[model samples]
Target: MLTSLEFRLLATAKAAPELRHRLRDHGHDVRLCATELLTNVIDHLGEGTPVTVRVIGTAAEHGRVRVEVTDPAPDSPPVLRSAAGWEESGRGLALVDALAERWGVDVGPDRKTVWCELVGDGRADGRPVSGAARPTAPARGR
Candidate 1:
């Protein structure tokens, strides 16, 4: 599934439910990660930046979901950094690193996409494809 959203902080709240619906089982992680990514865009790139979100699932990944957020700033990419305990900010990527199985940034000529993959056992509805719904269910036992 793919969604295009405005770069406002309000859009994050609006987009969260939709992301949760699409992700279903791992909605919380998807929502949180997506929000962090968007918040980063708003904070660094300013508001009203265009964003495209894509959710992908793959059987080869053993029930993993990949969420990608595309924005128009290839020059300003996200970086991971350690935040001091008293710091009130700079924990976005840190949270992403902790929650996402893996995350990365793909920079193009005029834009970049920040992506994160999350592992879950929930049933996915489609084969491994971009912009397609591939719900996954947890395996039996361990």
Candidate 2:
């Protein structure tokens, strides 16, 4: 499923339920990651920017869901960085990293899409599979 909307304060509120409905068991992770990505677009690109949110289900038996947030700024890719405890922000992507099986950015000529995949199976706990080899570098696509 795909939704296109302007990134606003209430955008997440509206998008969350839809994502939950589409993602089913993986709703929580998808909602949180989508929120973080939308928030990033609003914070960095300014509010009211047009963005597209996509949720795709892959590997149904394993409960894998992919979430993608596409924004108009191709040059302003998201960067994952360490945030001091004193800081109030900058933890969004870190939270995404912890929850997602894998995440990456895809840049096009005019826009960029930040995406993450979450696997809902293989762990009794909702967290990602233990000892899974997560990529140290962000995956980028043209």
Candidate 3:
């Protein structure tokens, strides 16, 4: 799904608490994760660009929560490599690497998509959330 953000802190930071309220605190982390990823997408690239966020809750191995933010960029794909000892900037991907259970980039000549996944409680049983109340078996046993 896609949402609008003015690419400013006034909108981004202010959004977290309000979102946490609706999701009953369970989604607070995911919200913040989106905030960070989206924030980077906005700050490091062109202004007023649209962002696409896809959130899927799955139960495979229990289940995993995946958050993907897609935007237009061709300069560089985010990487987990550490900044040199003296550099004062370029730590964002490093931080993302440290925080996410899994993270990577989907790149083409046109745009780059950076994705991150966090292990959630539902993932312990290996199922994917289906419509409403149904659950599907994992494609492969863990």
lDDT of each residue in 10-118, candidate 1, tens digit only: 3344555555565554456766787788778767887667777655555354566566678888999788899899999899989988988888887789998888777
Model 2 reaches what TM-score against the true structure? Answer: 0.69
lDDT of 2 by residue, 51-89 (tens): 887655443334665667888899999989889999998
The whole-model lDDT of each prediction reads 0.64, 0.66, 0.53
lDDT of 1: 0.64
Residue pairs with backbone overlap in model 2: none
- What number of clashing residue pairs does each candidate have, in the order they appear? 13, 0, 17
Candidate 3 structure quality by residue, lDDT tens digits, 87-136? 97566666666656877767668776676666663222333433333332
- CA shift of 47, model 3, Å: 2.7
* Cα TM-score per model: 0.69, 0.69, 0.58
lDDT of 1 at 80: 88
Task: Tell me how far the alpha carbon of residue 6 in candidate 2 is from the true structure, in angstroms, after superposition.
Answer: 13
